[model samples]
Target: MTRSVSALKGQDTQLNCLFQFPPEQTYNRSVWFIHKGKEHESCLTDEPPLHITINYTERFSLAANIKNGSCTLGIRSITISDERRYCFRFYTNENRWTDKGGVTLRVKATPVISELYLKEPPNEGITNNITCKVSNVYPRESLNIALCADIVPKNETLSEQREPDLTFNVIKTVVFTPSKFHHQKYCTCNVTHSALQQPLLKTVIIEFQYNSNIAVGVGITTILLLFIIIIVLLYCYKQTKGKGKAMSMSSTLPTNNAAHSENAVEAPSQESQTEGNIVNEHFEEPGLVYSEVEFSQKEKQNNKPNEDQQMHMTEYSSVAFRKY
Candidate 1:
């Protein structure tokens, strides 16, 4: 049996050899060989072949499930030197021999990481560009690379280009605008190959700054609001003070007016007392002269009176003179 396998470099490769022979003719005995440089190289036999090359000794192994008539070669971490053709043969004690299909092992080169960048500036409302590239990918295999954004917009997809296996770094640029919707958006780079369905994704986050105009406007508006509040406070303070003063005046004015009226009435009473004394003195002295003439005539008529009656009259006249 012969087998061949093609795998990317630094990857594991498996080769299978299929052979069919009569069950009675061939037992479980099988021999696997490697042909390199136009020479047959013995690799493994039923007794475990000895003195294998250093490159194949550790990483190469064989599996034979003879019941299924199949042989498998497993190569781990394959390199360029591992590329070769292999052959398998089955032998039996009855002198019967059967050959299996040969195999060719090919190693493909691994792709290289290319360019990576952000699509746009790290500011709000600006379009950002994110790019990722890989070089030297196998052309025979379908290469699917994707650019994933942390925020994937509807109806948006990544773009790609292809070239032959020689130094082809696929460049994909995605345009994105930073927004509140993409507050914590992440940009990712993905790569897919024929053997792997799930893509390998690399993520990067794009940070956006707050909008300066909005911040400044908010600050200015806040200041203006504060200023208006202060003015209102001052006006209210003045109004309160004026109201207090008016209240105090309205309560005290009636008491002051009543005190002044009481003092005015007392002043008039004092002035009237001084004028009454002056009028009484002026009337007392002038009234005696008119009555004197009439009294003289009455005295002449009473000349014949007794001595005792005359004494009483004299006393009465003296008292009256003093009282006046």
Candidate 2:
């Protein structure tokens, strides 16, 4: 079986090889070798590939199925020294001729910082920018870029880069203003490689402010003024209701006084009628002094009793006394 190792480096990298041979050469045995610097190091060679090293070993392994004519090489925790050309040799039981395949290994290192910038600052009716830069990236690989803003209408931008150690700047510009409704919003920048987008390479957050204190003060003042106005209006309403009640009492007093005065006049009239009745009763009694006096007076006047009796005695007496 013949196999070729891929040119890649990592903790656990798979080396796969696919091949086809004549049925007679089916008894071919495979041998995998790792060449470091200028020396050839034997890793594994057999009909069924063998795992050459332990788990703690920095690097070693090989697996082959001579029946299927396929083999694979697994290297654990690879290092820079492991980055080299690998060879796979296939030999038949009867013949000594061997077929070989080679592969070049490349190591990937941690990403480095490239660049960072701000597009714009948050302002009234203005757009702001947030940018990030990354370096030492793989060529022709998709890059995951994101821009985050703390303000409303959060926006995100994603793109790709196709070069080694390329500088990628993702700019997210947001338009907003400082208002009473807004919270403390800021801008964030993130740069990620497509292979490992979960862990970000660079992240930055920028805060923008414009007279936030003034806006807060104004809002507070407006609320206070409204509260005061409400209190004043309530006070005025209570005062008006009190005054209406007082005025209503004052208006009713005159009618009450007039009715009382009428009642007083009627009561005196009733008393005067009762006194006249008593005087008549005394006049009817024979041998009563009051009756004799009245009879003598009537005779001296030479007036008929029936005609004089109907006249107002109090008025005639008052006139007579005045003449006297």
Candidate 3:
């Protein structure tokens, strides 16, 4: 059966082969050959000591112990061209053995994924470009690359260049148009190859400027509400001030009316008092006349002396003074 050997480019690899022979028989010579498409080409031969063929460097070596029936071929600094089948053949005096199902060398190079990013900063309603780059890839045909936006596949332009060492460098670019809906969405790149067990991924966020329409609307609404509150407060303040003035006026009206009514009552009482004083003076006039008549009779008696003393009894007097 065929044996498989896996190695990476610029690394060393070995192919191990084993065979069994009887104790009486021993291997005389052995050779290692590599399959070149449809033909076998000898690379190493061991008549007694190992011999490397032309176009092969010391990097290609063979270690063998024929009596023990083991042979191994080592290759250093392997390349993509070294990926092929290797056969080992042995000969003895009795018979010869050539291994047709040989060991296959699979050379691989791990692709390096670069950072995924945008060519320019994103803005709303603007077109942008997203890029993903991969380098150091061997067997370029087996490399697969994909670009996605928010987990959805996107159309991209694939470009590749051959490296100086016969490897590949690839670039994948996709055009992206950003909107408010895609502000926080993600842009991702996925890379897969036969050499990698898991796909490589690089992701970036699609951030952009937001639309100002909604913000402006909200700001206007807030200002309008503030204005309405101010107007209502002013109206309430004016109404309250007006009510205070009306209450003050109403409170003073009753006091003024009561004072006027008291003054009107006191004026009639003062006039009636004056009229009563005049009537009392008119009744006292008779007493004053009787006082004057008594004084005249006293004066006439004094004129007559002792003769008037006998006349004193004839002189009648009623003196009524006004009561103090």
Best by lDDT: 3
User: What are the per-residue Cα lDDT tens digits for candidate 2 across 1-324?
Assistant: 223343323466856764556666645555655543333333233332344212324466665564675756667765545666665666667643233335556655444446656565444444554555555444224554554544564454544454533333333344344343443444455546544536664455444455657678989999999999999999999999999999999999999999866744222232222112212213334433232113343344553334235334433322211111
Candidate 1 has its poorest 10 consecutive residues by lDDT at: 273-282
**Candidate 3 runs further than 4 Å off:** 21-26, 39-57, 93-95, 151-154, 210-324
> Candidate 1 residues 58-80, lDDT tens each?
68776556568676767788765
Find the candidate with the highest TM-score and give its number. 3
Q: Give the TM-score comparing model 2 with the true structure, all chains together.
A: 0.32
Better of 2 and 3 by TM-score: 3
Note the Cα lDDT for every prediction shown.
0.59, 0.50, 0.70
The per-residue C-alpha lDDT of model 3 at residue 150 equals 62
List where candidate 2 sits over 4 angstroms from the true fold: 1-4, 12-76, 80-102, 108-142, 146-219, 249-324
State how far residue 239 of model 3 sits from its true place (Å): 22
RMSD of each: 20.3, 17.5, 19.8
Candidate 1, which segments miss by more than 4 Å at Cα? 1-4, 9-107, 112-115, 154-165, 195-198, 263-324
TM-score per candidate: 0.46, 0.32, 0.55
The 10-residue segment of model 3 with minimum total lDDT is 271-280
